[model samples]
Each structure stands twice: as C-alpha cells, then as structure tokens.
Target: MYIIQKLINRFFVKNKLGIFSFTFFIVIFSSVVMQILEPKTFPRWFDALWYVMTTVTTVGYGDFYPVTVAGRMYAIFIFLVGIGIAGLAIGKLVEAMGAHRKRKEEGRLTFKGKNHFVIIGWSEKAKYAINEITETHPNLEVVLIDRLPVTPITHQNVHYIQGDPSIESTLIQANIEEAQSVLVFSDDSIHDSALADGKTLLIVTSVERLTPHIHSTVEIKREEHIKNFRHAKVDEFVLSHETVSRMAVRSAFSKGITGIYTQLLSHKEGENLFEVQKKAEWRTYKDAFDGLLEQGATLIADGNDLSINKKLNEAIPEDARLYIICSKDVYEALA
Candidate 1:
C-alpha cells in the first residue's frame, strides 16, 4: 500500500497521454517477461496478454498460472506495480472526459456544424425564437452567440458560443461562413432604442464582412434606424417597436386579431404560413391559385407580392417563390 501511494504521488503528476503510454509499456513488458519465464503456462503472446490484463485488473481468472519459481516471482512483481499503473490510466481517462465536458459547457469550444442558424444575443425573445425554430425543424441545428460566461440554455440541437458577436474571431468560431442564416437581436438590457439598434448594426456589419453570402435578419428597436442598416447589405429588417405597436392597434380595433397573428406566425395548433415550390404546370398565377385552392390551401402570395388575385393572368416567372396558408396536416398532405 505504501509503495502504491508513493508511485501515484510521483508519476501521476504527468498528463493523461503520458500516464496511458507508460501503462501500455508496462502491460507489454509484463506480457513479454511472463511468456519468457513460463513458456508452458503462456505459450502464445495473446495468452500472456490476457493473463497480465486479468492479474492487473484483479479479476484473477486462474485459468493460467505460473508453475516455475522464476515465473511466480515475476508475477509477484506484476501484482505490485501493474495494479497501480492500471488505476492511474483509468483515472486520467475519466479526468480527460470530464474536462472536455466542462470546456463545452463553458462555450470555449468551436462549433463545426454547417448550414445552421446562428442567433446572436440572449434574451426572452431569443429563447422564444429558439423554441419556434426547433419546433418547426427538429433536425436543423442552432448556434447561439453571446457574451455570457456560461451557456444559458441546453439542448441537443443547439450550440452556445460565448463571445462578442462583433468580433470576427468569435464569428469564425461559430462557423458563420457556412451558416444558413444569422439573426441579430438588439440587446434587451439596453433601454435606449438608438443604442440598442446601434449595437445590432455593429453585429450585422461584422457578420456581413465575414460572410458576404450569408442571409442576415436584424431586429431594431426603432423604425427610423433601418436606413442606417441598409449600407450593411442586411437581407431583412424586423421592426420590433412598429410591429408591436401595429399589433396592439389592430387588436384594440378588431376582436380576436391577436390570435390570428399568432396562428400565422407560430407552429402551433392552427393555420400557419408555409412556402411551397413553384410547379412547372402552373404557367400563370391563376393556375397556381386555383390548384392550391382545390388542394385546401390558400395561395397567399408569390414571394412578397400579395396582389395575385388582381394579376391572375400574369405569367409565373421562372424564379417565382410561392407561399400558402394551411393547417399542419393539410400542408403535410399536399406535400
């Protein structure tokens, strides 16, 4: 026991690889020495290895035992030192696994997933967005970037990166160049609308500089601040304040309007907006509208153009993007 403690204190200070390498050397040496001492007991190298492993682990299945005096002496030597080496190797392996998990939870590891959604900032709104995205597409991955020391949320499909979103290195760590899209949310902690929008603009500028082809959606507190974001070439702007104000006004004037908006925006148990591929047979807007209507789906728009009813005779362009509103099962049936 005393010798075992001393061996641990002296050599266990080495890193994981060192300890494991030494353990492997000791195991090989024991197998070789055992075979040389007692060829009758361990005729093959594999037999010697099995005997050495069983003895060191204390399993001691006595199928093979040394008959000669010299072989027993070497076996005693193995019993004393080999057990401690085996324990040290196992301890180091467990320690390495635990350290790796800690680094991942601290958001100190780089994300390697491609074609994923990268959401910047941590807030209630960001949490809701994460939930909505996961519910809509369970297979897609989402990476969240923020300055918090530790990750705020934990999910199988979501990865967290702790850093300033405006830094190029931080964006690189999140694999922004290969990401499908990026959503930059104004910091909820900043009370000033101009300052919040300014922070969002900085993040968007950094993202666009690193990934010119990536689609970027940004949220701004004030509607007038969108003009400043235009130079950054942001793909979409979400006006937070104006949208809420309009929703509140509509709800006040009309009954049950909020529920309609929620159904259209969410993946919940109601009708929702979905995009479908343009068919080759639909030569005109009228054909698409009539075909989708017969299939129990309302053709709402072609891309952002909602005047399809007035332009029913208009030719459907080659790049036309179609959108529809339908129940979940109805959409699935049509799909």
Candidate 2:
C-alpha cells in the first residue's frame, strides 16, 4: 500500500497529465504485448489482436476465442489491465468534452441562424423577457450572452453563451447578424438601477453600432432613465418599476380587475395581447376587423388605448397599431 501510495503521489501529484498519458500508453502496451504473446500459443495473431482491440475499447465483439490453457490465462490478465485503460481513456474523453462545452458556452464559439432573438445582459428581467417571448413565439430561438455562468433552463429552445454582451465578438456568438431583434437588460450586479441603465445603454449603443437595422428593446430600471435611452434609439423601453407600480395600484383599488389584464399580458396559455400591422390591402377598419375575425382573432383596440374599438364607418388611421387578442398559436397562425 505504501509503495502504491508513493507511486501515485509521484505520478499524479507531480505531473498529472503526464501520468494520465503514461497510463494510456501502458494500457496499450500491455494489450499489445498480451495479444502478441498469447497468439504464439493460440496460433491466430490477427484474431487475437482484434480481440485485444475490442476488449480494450469495451466493444466486446465476441468473434475471437482463447481456447488454449495459456491463452485463457493471458485473457484474464488482459481483462484486468484493459479495464483500467478503458476507464482512464473514458475519463480523459469526458474532461475534453466538458472543456469543449465550457468554451462554447463562454462565447468562444459561433454559429448562425435566421430570425433569432439575441438577448444581451443576464438578470431576472432578462429571464422574464425570455419566458414571455418563448410563450408567445415558441419557434423563436433565443441566444443569451452575459459575463456569468448561464445555467440551463427547462426549455431547450434557448441557447446561452456566457460573455460580455457589450463586446462585438460576444454578440457574434449569439449570431446578432442574422438576428431579427435584440433585448438589452441592465446588469443586476450594479448597485444602482441608474448604473444598470447606463450599462444597458452602453450595450444598446454597441449593438446598434454592430447591427444598425436590427430592432432592439432596452429595459429601464427607472422611468427617469427613459429619456437618456431615447438617444440610443431603442425600439422599445420596458419600464419595470412603472409596470409593477401600476399593477400594485390597480390591485389596491380594484380586486381581481388587474389580474385579468395581467393574465392577458403575462404571455401565459390563455388570452394574449399582440400588435399586428395594419395592412394597406385591407382599406377599411371593418375589412381588417372581419379578416382578423375569420382568422380566429379578436380585435382589442388601437395601441394601448383599449377603449376605442374601430367603428364600422370609422376610417382606419394609417399610423394606428391594431391590438389583437388571441392565443399564441392563433397569433402565429394568423400573423
């Protein structure tokens, strides 16, 4: 035991990789030596060698045999030594595989896809956005990039690459070039929301610099930061605090009323709110409304102004965004 301990300490402690490599070589040598020596007694070199290769790889082809007494004794030793070598080879293989996965996750890898959403920054809000998007558009693939270990979620549709999203190279891993939209969230590590907003602004600016025409949304931790984000030209600003405050106030004043609206916007399985483009082919409001009805969609209203339902005689404004209430499946099919 003491001699084994000393050898292990000398091999593993002093030179870890050298020990692993040496162990591999020793296994190969033992198998080769066993096959060559055993073949002299068995009189089948090629068959014995094939058996050795299969046994060492755990393939167990079972075609070759060691019928002779000497060859059977050799087979016993080969099994013992071959097991050790197989284990070491598997361990090394697993380690290499893990390393490759880490590099791919850390944005040191790149791939391309069409109509993907590149999510920049990692936070609770970022996850919320991912959930929302996935619920609404299950087919839409999401690529998350941030400077932290991105743990996997239940949904395999989402891909995560850990790195600084503000960097151009990191964005490339998320395939920002082919991405249809970008969602920028503030880093939660920053002490202040304004600081987080500043980081988000920087990321947005960088993304805009990289992909000029891509539609991007920036989340604002504070409503006051919205104006500063305007200069960055973000397509949408999600005011986290404002939305929460509105929910709280609504719940305080009227019980269960806010819950209905919340459910519609929550991107859950039930009803969902979506903004559909008003097509010019449909000239009148009634025409568009009837078209949506035929497609199994309920016309909600124009923009956030939900009270005004387009009248039969009412002219459809060219600039108005049509709000439609439908299921995600319906939205995807109708859109």
Candidate 3:
C-alpha cells in the first residue's frame, strides 16, 4: 500500500501526462471490476463503463447501480479518486490554452510561413502600410516586428513579433529569409533625422546580411542620407520628409495635384497604378501600349522608365516590368 501510494504521488502530482494516464487507467479498471463483481447487475462491459463515466463526471444519471457488497465498495473508491483527477486534467488543459495565448501576445513565438512581407518598426505609417496590404490581399500574411510589449494591431493576415529587428535572431524569428520583401520604416520616436536614418540603415544592413537577394525598401528622413544606404543593397527608398515637401510644393503650384498623387499612390480609390506582364506576341512598346489602351487601360511606364511615348517604336525587352494605370475592373480583365 505504501509503495503504490508513492508511485501514484510521483506520477499524478508532478506530471500532467501521468495524471491523465492514471485517470484513464482508473476509469477503465473500475469499469472492468464493476462488470466482473456484478455480472448479474451490470450485464455488459459497456454498461459498466457508462456508469463509471457518469459517476466520475458527476452526471449521475441514476440508470445503473451496484447490487453487491464488493461492487459497492469498489464504486466508493473510484468515486473519490476518478472525479478529482478528471477535474485536475480539465484545469490543466485550460491553463495550457491561456499560456499559449500569453506567449503569442508577448511575441515569443516563431513564424514558419514563407513569401510573406515583413515590416520592421511600429508607427502610424506602418499601420497604414499593413492596412493597405491586407485590404488588397486579404488572404496574404504580413509579419510585423517591433519592440512593443504587445502587438499593436490584430488582423488575420498580420503577425507581430516583439524584438529588436537589427538583431539576426529577431529577423530569423520573423522568418525574413523566406520573405518576399521587407519594408523598414524610420523610427518616429527619434527626434534627430540622422539618428533615425542611422537606425534604419543598421536595420537594413542586418537584413541584407541575412538575405542578400531579398528586395528591401526603406524610409529615409533626409534625402542626403540616401547615399549611406546604397551599400546595404536597398531596392527602394521613400524619402518621407522630402516626398511630403515635394508633394506640398506641387500641390501649391498646381490645383488638385495632391489628388493625383494620392490616386497614384493608393489603390483603394480611383484608377490606381498596377503592374502587368508583357505578353509574348507584343513585340514593341506600341503594340503593348495599344493593346492595353484598347482594354481601357493606359500603359504609362515600362518599369521606372515612364517615357513610354519616346520608346514606343522600340522593341519591348523580355524582362520588362510594364506598369499601367486603369480601373480595378480593367486591370483584373487584363490580368
């Protein structure tokens, strides 16, 4: 009796798996004992099992009962141990679920997904960028990295990680290697432009070191600092202050110019810009241009070379990434 008590204590008190295993064993053993001791009362093994389950669960349907002295004594023993152990198992399950949620909120989990966009930094601009991405591709996943105590935004496509993004481990946590692209935003809390750009440059350097070929876009507070990031192999840089100043100046010189920039930049409203694949049969810029124009879409640029009119007669290159401006319906049809 002493040895069995010690064994039960070691298994049931210390280990949750052991507790569950012992509970299952006790229930099955109790059912079989009841069937054997009261073959006249409990005619089948299933009937004994049903009675044991109902008693342990405290359901007590009162449809089955023991008619012999030995069966009644066994029932009393099972009633004490089985119900308590079952309750313990249920409590452990709830605790495990809560721990999982806490770990997710604290950003301690690793993302194992691929081809997702990774955004570094937590700011208003980051929020807008994620919202735009989610709105466009509702099913696509976007992983966000920041140092906040908890995730800022909760969406089906958005995942948040709390860590210093410049560190290789944090980037690995975000799964940056398999990511489609990365967007590094300037830290808004820093007051000095140089400091902000410097931090952003460090983050970009870490990104390039880990994934050399991945496309990276960065936000620069000053235009002069753009040269510093060239070695980091950043694919694009959005001059946050300079772009806004230029847009303000353009809006001042021309009426409703801001609206044009807004329409071009945002895809949620108006005829937005979209990238289209150049068809094989379209030999020249003119052929591609005319084909798209007939579909109510205008081919404005072949990549960054927006002067399509000058190059209309030139043969389209095989690697051309043609961009067009058209309504969503027209772009969908062409796509």
Candidate 1: residue 111 Cα off by (Å): 0.5
**Compared with the true structure, what per-residue lDDT tens digits does model 3 show for residues 1-335?**
99998887788776879878888898899999999999988899999999999999889999999988999998889788889987877777788789988888888889999999999999999999999999888888999999999999988778889999999999999999999999999999999999999999999999999999899999999988888898778999999989999999989999898988888889877989999998987999999999998999999998789899998999998999999999988988987
On lDDT, the stronger of 1 and 2 is 1
Query: Of the candidates numbered 1 and 2, which has the greater TM-score value?
Result: 1
The parts of candidate 1 lying over 4 Å away from their true place are 1-12, 32-47, 59-68
TM-scores across all candidates? 0.90, 0.67, 0.88
**Model 2, 111: alpha-carbon shift in Å?**
4.7
Candidate 3 shows a clash count of 0
Lowest lDDT block of 10, candidate 1:
8-17
Question: What does candidate 2 score on TM?
Answer: 0.67
**In the order shown, what is each candidate's alpha-carbon RMSD?**
3.1, 6.4, 3.1
lDDT agreement of model 3 with the native: 0.91
* Clash pairs for candidate 1: none
- Stretches of candidate 3 exceeding 4 Å from the true structure: 1-14, 27-55, 59-75
Residue 39 miss distance in model 1 (angstroms): 5.1
Clashing pairs in 2: 146-163
| Candidate 1 lDDT (Cα, 0 to 1) | 0.91
The Cα RMSD in angstroms, rounded to one decimal, for candidate 3 relative to the true structure is 3.1
